[model samples]
Target: MDETASPVESADCRAISEVLSRVGDKWTMQVVVTLSDGPRRFNDLKRRVEGISQQMLTRTLKALERDGMVKRTVCATTPPQVEYDLTALGRSLAEPARRLAQWVRGHLGIIHANRRQYDSRR
Candidate 1:
Protein backbone atom coordinates (compact mmCIF):
# COMPACT_ATOMS: atom_id res chain seq x y z
CA MET A 1 0.00 0.00 0.00
CA ASP A 2 1.22 3.44 -0.85
CA GLU A 3 1.49 5.85 2.06
CA THR A 4 -0.82 8.39 0.44
CA ALA A 5 -3.45 5.87 -0.74
CA SER A 6 -6.64 5.53 1.27
CA PRO A 7 -7.98 2.21 2.54
CA VAL A 8 -10.74 2.14 -0.04
CA GLU A 9 -8.28 2.69 -2.86
CA SER A 10 -6.06 -0.08 -1.58
CA ALA A 11 -8.99 -2.46 -1.33
CA ASP A 12 -10.09 -1.56 -4.84
CA CYS A 13 -6.58 -2.15 -6.12
CA ARG A 14 -6.47 -5.55 -4.43
CA ALA A 15 -9.78 -6.56 -5.97
CA ILE A 16 -8.66 -5.40 -9.39
CA SER A 17 -5.38 -7.26 -9.04
CA GLU A 18 -7.15 -10.49 -8.14
CA VAL A 19 -9.47 -10.26 -11.14
CA LEU A 20 -6.59 -9.36 -13.44
CA SER A 21 -4.64 -12.35 -12.21
CA ARG A 22 -7.48 -14.59 -13.34
CA VAL A 23 -8.15 -12.88 -16.68
CA GLY A 24 -4.49 -12.23 -17.43
CA ASP A 25 -3.49 -15.87 -17.04
CA LYS A 26 -1.71 -17.37 -20.05
CA TRP A 27 -4.65 -19.52 -21.18
CA THR A 28 -7.56 -17.40 -19.95
CA MET A 29 -7.88 -14.97 -22.85
CA GLN A 30 -7.46 -17.79 -25.32
CA VAL A 31 -10.17 -19.82 -23.64
CA VAL A 32 -12.48 -16.83 -23.48
CA VAL A 33 -11.93 -16.04 -27.16
CA THR A 34 -12.59 -19.65 -28.18
CA LEU A 35 -15.80 -19.80 -26.16
CA SER A 36 -16.99 -16.57 -27.75
CA ASP A 37 -17.88 -18.52 -30.85
CA GLY A 38 -20.36 -20.73 -28.92
CA PRO A 39 -20.57 -23.54 -26.41
CA ARG A 40 -18.18 -26.43 -26.82
CA ARG A 41 -17.46 -29.80 -25.28
CA PHE A 42 -14.27 -30.45 -23.31
CA ASN A 43 -12.37 -32.26 -26.04
CA ASP A 44 -13.40 -29.76 -28.69
CA LEU A 45 -12.21 -26.87 -26.57
CA LYS A 46 -8.95 -28.69 -25.90
CA ARG A 47 -8.39 -29.20 -29.61
CA ARG A 48 -9.19 -25.61 -30.59
CA VAL A 49 -7.03 -24.07 -27.88
CA GLU A 50 -3.88 -25.63 -29.35
CA GLY A 51 -1.04 -26.79 -27.09
CA ILE A 52 -3.25 -26.86 -24.03
CA SER A 53 -3.13 -30.17 -22.19
CA GLN A 54 -6.25 -31.89 -20.94
CA GLN A 55 -5.36 -31.11 -17.31
CA MET A 56 -4.63 -27.48 -18.01
CA LEU A 57 -7.88 -27.04 -19.92
CA THR A 58 -9.78 -28.65 -17.12
CA ARG A 59 -8.18 -26.32 -14.58
CA THR A 60 -8.80 -23.26 -16.71
CA LEU A 61 -12.44 -24.16 -17.21
CA LYS A 62 -12.89 -24.73 -13.52
CA ALA A 63 -11.32 -21.40 -12.67
CA LEU A 64 -13.41 -19.57 -15.25
CA GLU A 65 -16.54 -21.25 -13.91
CA ARG A 66 -15.59 -20.33 -10.37
CA ASP A 67 -15.17 -16.70 -11.42
CA GLY A 68 -18.64 -16.57 -13.00
CA MET A 69 -17.10 -15.98 -16.42
CA VAL A 70 -18.08 -19.41 -17.74
CA LYS A 71 -21.11 -21.65 -17.59
CA ARG A 72 -20.77 -25.43 -17.43
CA THR A 73 -23.71 -27.66 -18.25
CA VAL A 74 -23.93 -31.40 -18.12
CA CYS A 75 -26.24 -33.14 -20.51
CA ALA A 76 -28.27 -36.01 -19.16
CA THR A 77 -27.18 -38.64 -21.59
CA THR A 78 -25.55 -42.07 -21.53
CA PRO A 79 -22.11 -40.82 -20.64
CA PRO A 80 -23.22 -37.34 -19.53
CA GLN A 81 -21.77 -34.90 -22.00
CA VAL A 82 -20.41 -31.72 -20.48
CA GLU A 83 -20.36 -28.40 -22.29
CA TYR A 84 -18.77 -25.06 -21.46
CA ASP A 85 -19.74 -21.62 -22.64
CA LEU A 86 -19.21 -18.01 -21.76
CA THR A 87 -21.67 -16.40 -19.38
CA ALA A 88 -22.90 -12.82 -19.82
CA LEU A 89 -19.93 -11.63 -17.80
CA GLY A 90 -17.63 -13.74 -19.94
CA ARG A 91 -19.24 -12.38 -23.11
CA SER A 92 -18.64 -8.87 -21.81
CA LEU A 93 -14.95 -9.71 -21.50
CA ALA A 94 -14.61 -11.19 -24.98
CA GLU A 95 -14.60 -7.94 -26.98
CA PRO A 96 -11.99 -6.36 -24.77
CA ALA A 97 -9.91 -9.53 -24.85
CA ARG A 98 -10.07 -9.61 -28.63
CA ARG A 99 -9.05 -5.97 -28.81
CA LEU A 100 -6.15 -6.61 -26.50
CA ALA A 101 -5.02 -9.55 -28.62
CA GLN A 102 -5.29 -7.42 -31.73
CA TRP A 103 -3.23 -4.71 -30.09
CA VAL A 104 -0.57 -7.25 -29.15
CA ARG A 105 -0.48 -8.67 -32.66
CA GLY A 106 -0.26 -5.17 -34.14
CA HIS A 107 2.59 -4.22 -31.81
CA LEU A 108 4.54 -7.46 -31.94
CA GLY A 109 7.21 -6.07 -34.23
CA ILE A 110 7.90 -3.02 -32.11
CA ILE A 111 7.63 -5.07 -28.92
CA HIS A 112 10.11 -7.63 -30.21
CA ALA A 113 12.45 -4.91 -31.35
CA ASN A 114 12.29 -3.27 -27.97
CA ARG A 115 12.94 -6.58 -26.27
CA ARG A 116 15.93 -7.27 -28.51
CA GLN A 117 17.35 -3.84 -27.91
CA TYR A 118 16.88 -4.16 -24.18
CA ASP A 119 18.49 -7.61 -24.14
CA SER A 120 21.47 -6.41 -26.17
CA ARG A 121 21.96 -3.46 -23.82
CA ARG A 122 21.87 -5.81 -20.86
Candidate 2:
Protein backbone atom coordinates (compact mmCIF):
# COMPACT_ATOMS: atom_id res chain seq x y z
CA MET A 1 0.00 0.00 0.00
CA ASP A 2 1.18 3.54 -0.74
CA GLU A 3 2.08 5.41 2.44
CA THR A 4 2.32 8.96 1.17
CA ALA A 5 -0.85 11.00 0.84
CA SER A 6 -1.57 13.21 -2.15
CA PRO A 7 -1.26 17.00 -1.81
CA VAL A 8 -4.70 18.52 -1.73
CA GLU A 9 -6.54 21.76 -1.24
CA SER A 10 -8.49 22.29 1.94
CA ALA A 11 -11.51 24.35 2.93
CA ASP A 12 -9.74 25.75 5.98
CA CYS A 13 -6.90 27.10 3.91
CA ARG A 14 -9.27 28.91 1.52
CA ALA A 15 -11.24 30.42 4.40
CA ILE A 16 -8.11 31.68 6.13
CA SER A 17 -6.78 33.13 2.87
CA GLU A 18 -10.04 34.93 2.25
CA VAL A 19 -9.97 36.38 5.74
CA LEU A 20 -6.37 37.53 5.31
CA SER A 21 -7.27 39.22 2.05
CA ARG A 22 -10.01 41.16 3.78
CA VAL A 23 -7.86 42.26 6.72
CA GLY A 24 -4.82 42.97 4.59
CA ASP A 25 -6.46 45.87 2.77
CA LYS A 26 -4.82 49.29 3.28
CA TRP A 27 -7.67 50.93 5.12
CA THR A 28 -8.83 47.82 6.95
CA MET A 29 -5.92 47.65 9.33
CA GLN A 30 -6.05 51.36 10.04
CA VAL A 31 -9.77 51.23 10.60
CA VAL A 32 -9.32 48.27 12.89
CA VAL A 33 -6.67 50.10 14.83
CA THR A 34 -8.83 53.17 15.17
CA LEU A 35 -11.83 51.23 16.43
CA SER A 36 -9.73 49.22 18.84
CA ASP A 37 -9.65 52.16 21.25
CA GLY A 38 -13.40 52.28 21.90
CA PRO A 39 -16.74 52.89 20.26
CA ARG A 40 -16.64 55.87 17.94
CA ARG A 41 -19.18 57.74 15.90
CA PHE A 42 -18.97 57.74 12.11
CA ASN A 43 -17.87 61.35 11.93
CA ASP A 44 -15.38 60.85 14.74
CA LEU A 45 -13.71 57.97 12.93
CA LYS A 46 -13.50 59.95 9.71
CA ARG A 47 -11.92 62.84 11.59
CA ARG A 48 -9.48 60.68 13.51
CA VAL A 49 -8.25 58.72 10.51
CA GLU A 50 -6.49 61.29 8.41
CA GLY A 51 -6.69 61.13 4.59
CA ILE A 52 -9.84 59.01 4.67
CA SER A 53 -12.77 60.31 2.66
CA GLN A 54 -16.29 59.88 4.01
CA GLN A 55 -17.15 57.32 1.33
CA MET A 56 -14.00 55.32 1.91
CA LEU A 57 -14.59 55.25 5.64
CA THR A 58 -18.16 54.11 5.17
CA ARG A 59 -17.08 51.37 2.77
CA THR A 60 -14.28 50.22 5.05
CA LEU A 61 -16.56 50.10 8.07
CA LYS A 62 -19.18 48.18 6.11
CA ALA A 63 -16.60 45.66 4.99
CA LEU A 64 -15.36 45.26 8.57
CA GLU A 65 -18.92 44.68 9.70
CA ARG A 66 -19.40 42.04 6.99
CA ASP A 67 -16.21 40.34 8.18
CA GLY A 68 -17.52 40.12 11.75
CA MET A 69 -14.77 42.33 13.13
CA VAL A 70 -16.96 45.34 13.84
CA LYS A 71 -20.32 45.93 15.40
CA ARG A 72 -22.49 48.86 14.38
CA THR A 73 -25.07 50.13 16.80
CA VAL A 74 -27.78 52.67 16.32
CA CYS A 75 -28.72 54.76 19.29
CA ALA A 76 -32.07 56.41 19.63
CA THR A 77 -31.70 60.17 19.38
CA THR A 78 -33.16 63.09 17.55
CA PRO A 79 -31.05 62.51 14.45
CA PRO A 80 -30.26 58.80 14.91
CA GLN A 81 -26.80 58.21 16.28
CA VAL A 82 -24.55 55.49 14.87
CA GLU A 83 -21.40 54.13 16.45
CA TYR A 84 -18.85 51.42 15.76
CA ASP A 85 -16.94 49.18 18.14
CA LEU A 86 -14.72 46.21 17.77
CA THR A 87 -16.01 42.74 18.35
CA ALA A 88 -14.20 40.33 20.65
CA LEU A 89 -12.16 38.95 17.77
CA GLY A 90 -11.34 42.43 16.59
CA ARG A 91 -10.23 43.42 20.06
CA SER A 92 -7.93 40.41 20.08
CA LEU A 93 -5.94 41.97 17.25
CA ALA A 94 -5.09 45.06 19.33
CA GLU A 95 -1.88 43.59 20.70
CA PRO A 96 -0.57 42.69 17.25
CA ALA A 97 -1.55 46.04 15.76
CA ARG A 98 -0.02 47.84 18.72
CA ARG A 99 3.22 46.00 18.17
CA LEU A 100 3.19 46.86 14.47
CA ALA A 101 2.49 50.52 15.25
CA GLN A 102 5.32 50.62 17.75
CA TRP A 103 7.69 49.01 15.29
CA VAL A 104 6.74 51.56 12.64
CA ARG A 105 7.27 54.41 15.09
CA GLY A 106 10.70 53.04 15.97
CA HIS A 107 11.79 52.55 12.38
CA LEU A 108 10.20 55.62 10.80
CA GLY A 109 13.46 57.51 11.01
CA ILE A 110 15.26 54.90 8.97
CA ILE A 111 12.38 54.89 6.50
CA HIS A 112 12.48 58.64 6.09
CA ALA A 113 16.23 58.60 5.71
CA ASN A 114 15.98 55.95 3.02
CA ARG A 115 13.31 57.96 1.24
CA ARG A 116 15.48 61.07 1.30
CA GLN A 117 18.47 59.15 -0.03
CA TYR A 118 16.43 57.49 -2.72
CA ASP A 119 14.68 60.66 -3.79
CA SER A 120 18.00 62.53 -4.01
CA ARG A 121 19.39 59.88 -6.36
CA ARG A 122 16.34 60.14 -8.64
Q: What is the lDDT of residue 85 in candidate 1?
A: 95
Best by TM-score: 1
The pairs that clash in candidate 1 are none
Residues 16-55 of candidate 1 have per-residue lDDT tens digits of 9999999999899999999999999999999999999999
- Each candidate's number of clashing pairs is 0, 0
Q: What is the TM-score of each candidate against the true structure?
A: 0.95, 0.78
In model 1, where do residues sit more than 4 Å from their true spots?
none
Which runs of model 2 end up more than 4 angstroms from their true locations? 1-13, 112-122
lDDT of 1: 0.97
TM-score of 1: 0.95
Residue-wise C-alpha lDDT for candidate 2, range 30-93, written one tens digit per residue: 8889988899999999988889999999999998888788999999998999999999988887
